[model samples]
Target chain A: MIEVKNLIKEFEGRVVLDDISANFQKGAVNMIIGKSGSGKSVFLKCLVGLIRPTSGEIRYGGRNFLAMKNREMKRLRRDMGMLFQGSALFDSKTVLENVMFPLDVFSRKNQRERRKRAEFCLERVNLLDAADLFPSEISGGMMKRVAIARAIALNPKYLFCDEPNSGLDPKTSQMIDELIQDITRDFNMTSLVVSHDMNSVMNIGDYILFLNEGIKEWEGSKEHIMDSDNDKLNDFVFASDLFKKIKEADAIITGNEANEENRKKLIQRMEEEAKDL
Target chain B: MTITGSLENIGEYALLMKRVLTPPDRMREFFREFFKEMYKLGVNSIWIVVIISFFIGAVIVMQIALNVASPLLPRFTVGAVSREIILLEFSSTIMCLILSGKVGSNVATEIGTMRITEQVDALEIMGINSANYLILPKITAFVAFMPVLVIFSMFLGLYGGYVICYLTGTPPVSTYVYGIQAFFRESFVWYSIIKSMIFGFIIASVAAYYGYSVRGGALDVGRASTDSVVINSILILMTDLVFTQLAMG
Candidate 1:
């Protein structure tokens, strides 16, 4: 479990995250969803220890992430897999080498073992054919897949992805989402993703935390989001054409029940007229 | 067991030192990035260095010829002039200028780009020392290769002078050779090598510092690259003058 407690991050006297607290459950997809500049990215950065909160504690499975020593942080980071927004693939290395890099740095495994592990991870991401290609040689979606492979090469217990579907087509975005969900389930790793894409939210967001103006306004599963009575969330949901149609359908069903008694009276009158004739 | 605040700096310093000692293999992964940088520094500036060297050699040769060819001047004056210009000033100073543009800017830009891309952060998250993985090999390679480059520059400058002298028809081959043999001292060559070594260290460190300290984005990387070369070039010229006074005194 990842728990962020009363986190406050201030930049140059301006508040980015003000007294924000949330718990991310283990072995599932936990998403931080917000509009642009709503502090989701800052929250993710804080979770990874990239940016330390001004006054807060982030506990990773009962270990204090904020107060740990450098080596301890490093040790904890070793169990973390981060997929950067740009894929951040070492542009000079091929897919195989990029995937192999973490193992080479942290593991005592020999070249052959590292290669095999890297290939396995590549296959898991369905990027085995692209093992020899460089980041530039592949498409954006492919690069993300490669990044996913590299992220899981270490068999990390925790995964962090920042905007995994940005700049990708809808189909590719769905595929990436599915991959992330499948990987989370298969590996039983705690996954925390920061994204604003609604498709991803509806598809894979097992637990969603909604932020409004640097404060977490709501937290619930995607299944209950339609029934959530929060006006701000309602405005956001109804702002879309698809959600507006769904809203119209729901209102019609509720209003039809109140008119059912009048319809029964009209039916009795019609039956009396038929008997007299 | 130390706190993150104090230990972060220590880790940064350690990574910096490690980078100065070991070049990361990821550099190969980013070879295209490196080469695009090298093309800007190495290939594009070839004409500039060549032009500067040509004029500098010609001017030095002219001044030496006028002073030494006088009937009252000693025959050894030719060798003395060649030795002084080649060993102390021309080879060391000009090469430093050339490389301040080439290697210095490269280090700054490369590391700066890495910072912008969050690649450095990625490395840190992976438990690898970003500085050691990125910086060490470059410093080692620069320190190791600079003297060789300096020697090549010295020979090229001398050849430039030969061309100038031959065109002017003022000093015969025999006179030039005799004068060079008479005045050229072994100590001068050793001093030139030592000066170049110092210059190389200064250039690499300054460039790496700017590169590593870069914040923001690609624009900042560009600024860092420019700032490093300017700062490094100034330091090189200042150190060159100081070393010359010290050596000659």
Candidate 2:
């Protein structure tokens, strides 16, 4: 688990991440959701030491991350893996080489073992056939999968993904979300993802932290997100017609208007509507 | 740019070098990258250097023979002049100016794209020093390999003059060969090589600094590439002047 206390980040004179505190539990997909310019990315960067926080306590497995020396921080970073929004695969490297990069630098394994490990990772991502291809030769969805494979090659304890489905199609986004969720569960890794994808939020977000203009406006699980009473959260979440209709159906079912059969029918209808959209 | 801003840039560049010149995280990976850089930046550039040196060498010989044709000056003066110019300036300083535009821009654009695309950030997150991993090999390979390029430029340049004089036969091939051998200071060859080594560092490192400093998008990367070439050209010229004054004073 990771604990953040009063995390604040300032750029020049402006505060980008206000005093915010949250807990990210292990073995779960923790999502940070916010509008554009709402500090979601900033918060994630601060958590990973990409951006320095003005004041904060970031405790990763009970150790103070901010106070560690350079060597100690580098050692700790070995347990962390990050997926950038653009995938961040080395442009010159093949897909297998990309997967094997972190291992090549840090692994104690021999060359054959490293190759086998990379092949295994590519196979896990169902990308073994494309292992010899370069990143430019792959599709966007395939690139994201390759990035995910590279991220997990080290068997990292923490996985941080930033806008993993930003440019992917809906079907591919769902697949990517499921892949992240499955990896988190299989490895019991602490997964922190910064995303505004509502489908991903509802489908795979085990816990959610919502930010508004650099402040923590709301925080909860998907079960409570649609029913949230916070006006700003509701305005953001129910902005789309599909989500609004789903919320209406939810309210209708929860209210004194229907029996179990009708509620089940309404949920089935909602799922059908979601698929059609 | 303001004085403070210029100073800040210099300060940032100095700090970045401190980071870039450190020991590599893995020697095996470092050597692998080192050879790759040598092939990319050094070996790949040889053909262009040869072509340019040959043409420029021929031109220098023809121009010197035409303009300085006189009864007082020796007939071999054209060959000697061509040799001095190629050895002291063209092969070393001017050639680097051309490379600063080509190789310098290439490094800047490549690394700038990497920076904007977050590849460098990815390296940093993995506990690797991104500056060292990306820039050190380019700098080391270019520096180590520049002397070879300069040596080639020297030979091809003299050979071009040899070929041109034989074809034209104005001063006759014998006099031109004798002129090349006359007052030929081996020190000048070493000076050119050493000066080129310094320029090689300037080219690779300054371009990398610009590329790594890029922050915005593709346009910013282009601007950084242009900035690197311009800055590299200026610095190479200035360093050439300084080195020549110190060596020949």
Candidate 3:
């Protein structure tokens, strides 16, 4: 589990992450969700040590990440894996080499062992045929898969993904989301994902932390998100007409009884909204 | 920027150098990377250096022969002048200027693209010191290979002079050879080699500094590459002056 206490990050006197505190449980897809410029990325960066928090304590498995010495921090980082927004694959390296990179640096395994492990990782991602292909030769979704394969090569205990669904089509995005969720469960790792995609929020957000203007707006599971009465959360989540229609449909199905004629009218309105969308 | 900003950048550059100088976590990987860099920065650069030095040497000899219309001067003066210019300035300083465009911009563009694309961050996240992994091999490769290139430049430059002189028949081949052999101070060879090595360090490190510090997007990467070339050229020339003063004075 990861615990953050009074995390604050400032840039040029502008507050990006304000005194926010939250707990992310282990073996779950813990998501940080918010609109653009809402400090979701900043908060994630702080958690992963990409950006230093102005003042806070970040405890990873009960050890203070901020107070660790450089050597100690590096040792801890060995068990951490991150998938970047752009996939961040080494352009010059083939897929097999990319996945084997961490092992090459940190593993005591022999060359054949490293190659076997990398091949196993590629197979796990269903990318064994693409082992010899360079990153530029692959599609965006494939690149994300390759990145995931590389991230898990070291069998990290903590997995962080920054906007993993960005720039992907909806279907591919769903696949990536499922892959991340499955990996989290299978590896039993503490996974933190930063995203603004509501599909991801609804699909894989086992636990979600909502931020708005650098402050925590709400925190709960996807099951409880719709029941959240917070206006800001509602505005952000229901900004799309399709979700609004879904909310209305849910109300029609579960709320107090209505006449058939009124229910038909409401259903017709929702169908129109869905058509417009 | 302000004076304070400039100082801050210098401090940051120094810190990066310190980090790059740290020992690698894996010697096997370090050697593998080092040899790869040597092939890229050194072996790949030989053809260009050879071609440029030959032409520059030919041009220097031609210009010297054309200007020396005095019958009172010996024909060997042309060879001496060509040898001196090639050894003292052209091979070391001018070749470095050329390489500042080739290798320096390349280093900047490659690293800047990696920076913008977050590959460097990926390395850092993997618990590898990005500076040591990326820049150290480059520095070692350039420093080791540059002196060899300068020596090659010196030899080809003299050969170029010989080819021009032999073809022109104004300064006879023997006279040209005599001039090369005349007043051959061993110190000049050392000076040129030292200068080229220093130039190698400047080109690699300055370009790396700009590349590693890049922020923003593709436009910022282009700007960093251009800035790296400009800054490397200026520093190379400035360092040449200091070295010349210290060695020649």
Candidate 3 lDDT tens digits, B1-249: 789988998999999999999999898889988998899888889999999999889889889989985889988999998999999999999999999999998899899999999999999999899999999999999999998899999999999989998899868889989998899999899999989999999999989999999999999999989988998888889999998899997
- Could you give the TM-score of chain B for each candidate, in order? 0.77, 0.98, 0.97
> How far does residue B152 in candidate 3 sit from its true spot (Å)?
1.6
Q: By DockQ, is 2 or 3 better?
A: 2
True contacts kept of 3: 0.76
**Quality of candidate 1 docking, DockQ:** 0.39
lDDT of 2 by residue, A212-247 (tens): 999999999999998788999988898787897776
Cα distance off (Å), candidate 1, residue A126: 1.7
DockQ category of candidate 3 = high
Instruction: Report chain A TM-scores, every model.
Output: 0.90, 0.92, 0.94
Q: Which stretches of candidate 2 lie over 4 Å from their true place?
A: A257-277
Tell me the tens digit of each residue's lDDT in model 2 across B98-189: 88988999999999999999999999999999999999999999999999999999999989988999999967999999998899999999
DockQ of each: 0.39, 0.87, 0.86
Q: What tens digits encode model 3's per-residue C-alpha lDDT throughout A1-277?
A: 9999999999999999889999999999999989999998889888878889999899999999999999999999999999999999999899999999999999999999999999998898899999999999999999999999999999999999999999999999999999999999999999999998999989999999999999999999999998788999999999987787687777777765643554677779768989999
Q: Write down the lDDT of every candidate, Cα atoms only.
A: 0.80, 0.94, 0.92
* Candidate 2, residue A256: how far the Cα is off, in Å: 3.6
